[model samples]
Target: MGNDKKSELEQWLEALCSDPFSSILDETVFRVDVFETETEYIVESELINCTKEQIFVTCENDALIIQVHENENINKQRVVHLPFPLLNKNIRAYFTSPILEIHISKEISANHPNRYMITIHEIDL
Candidate 1:
């Protein structure tokens, strides 16, 4: 049973990598790391060239917590603790600048048998 689950996860990751939207993002400009704690999901990211820019991070479900740190002069940071577990499996975040844009999305679809879509948009901030 464990091997089956692992195989399923592998296939899903491959599909995400081949997604059209994934191809357009600047993979070098943003970094995402997921840390699993005993009861929460910790997602940390470092967004480059986004200091003074408006950052928007969202997840499909409202249960996951968020913490953001801006590498600016003042060292701005924000932490949001979610009320429940994120079950939608369509988490995303967007950062926009006058000349550059960054968007990140995880969990393209739910763990169910149906297909779902996750979209990210970046506009002038």
Candidate 2:
């Protein structure tokens, strides 16, 4: 098999492993990192050149949803699902220039069986 053409599978695999982050974020949503400490979950995101009114955050069914309303036609949405339950009321978010950080308090109590939608949290940039 000297210098023969590569199979379709080989090409697909090569593309899959190359620049994985770019492939993941084909949409307009910003990338984020969510990590857990002993007492809380920290969500870090960077929204450069974005105002406080353009950003929205909420939690539902253990999922943290972030929406950046750019325009009427183009809105970016990102969601992060928590492994364990979190206290919705205790959740807090902060914004300093380009950085948007969210802190969710860890909840070890009984889970809320009902699905509830939280009010849109507008970050103060």
Candidate 3:
């Protein structure tokens, strides 16, 4: 199939580098996709070889910071800035193996902390 004809999952998989080892040695932490709908913004991050327990997410001001760790020694961090100011309560996240999906609502759920850890729900996919 042509590039435009590919499914989202297929495109996502293909978007991942064919050489997986180089991702670790290279500066890029992981591949990320951010898109918006009428209701919310979706943040999808490809967290390769990482477990739900190894990932940490925090909402700080206008940015969502993702921290990943394979162990005490190996750590990687990525900061995703929001298109608009959002509260922590408006954010929800799920972890399914190599993909961590975060959904941010356009409307505020409630006033929460300026900096707080977001609960990561493990969903079978």
TM-scores for every candidate against the unseen true structure: 0.32, 0.61, 0.73
* lDDT of candidate 1 over 1-125, digit per residue (tens): 56456544345446645755534432633434434444334454555555324344434343222223355333323322333335545444433442222222343454522222223245554
Off by over 4 Å in 3: 1-27
User: Against the correct fold, how does model 3 do in TM-score?
Assistant: 0.73
Residue-by-residue lDDT tens digits, candidate 2, 7-93: 553464355347466347633457676556877768777787877667777777757777778775437776766555554436777
For residues 29-114, could you state the per-residue lDDT of candidate 3 as single tens digits?
77766766888778888898888889998898878888897656548887766545666448899998888999988776878978
After superposition, the stretches of candidate 2 with alpha carbons farther than 4 Å from their true spots are 1-23, 26-28, 72-74, 87-89, 108-125
Q: Could you tell which candidate, 2 or 3, scores higher by lDDT?
A: 3
Runs with alpha carbons beyond 4 Å of true place in candidate 1: 1-8, 27-46, 62-125
Provide the lDDT at 98 for model 3.
84
Cα-lDDT of candidate 1: 0.40
Higher-ranked by lDDT: 1 or 2: 2
Give the candidate order by descending TM-score: 3, 2, 1
Whole-model lDDT per candidate = 0.40, 0.64, 0.77
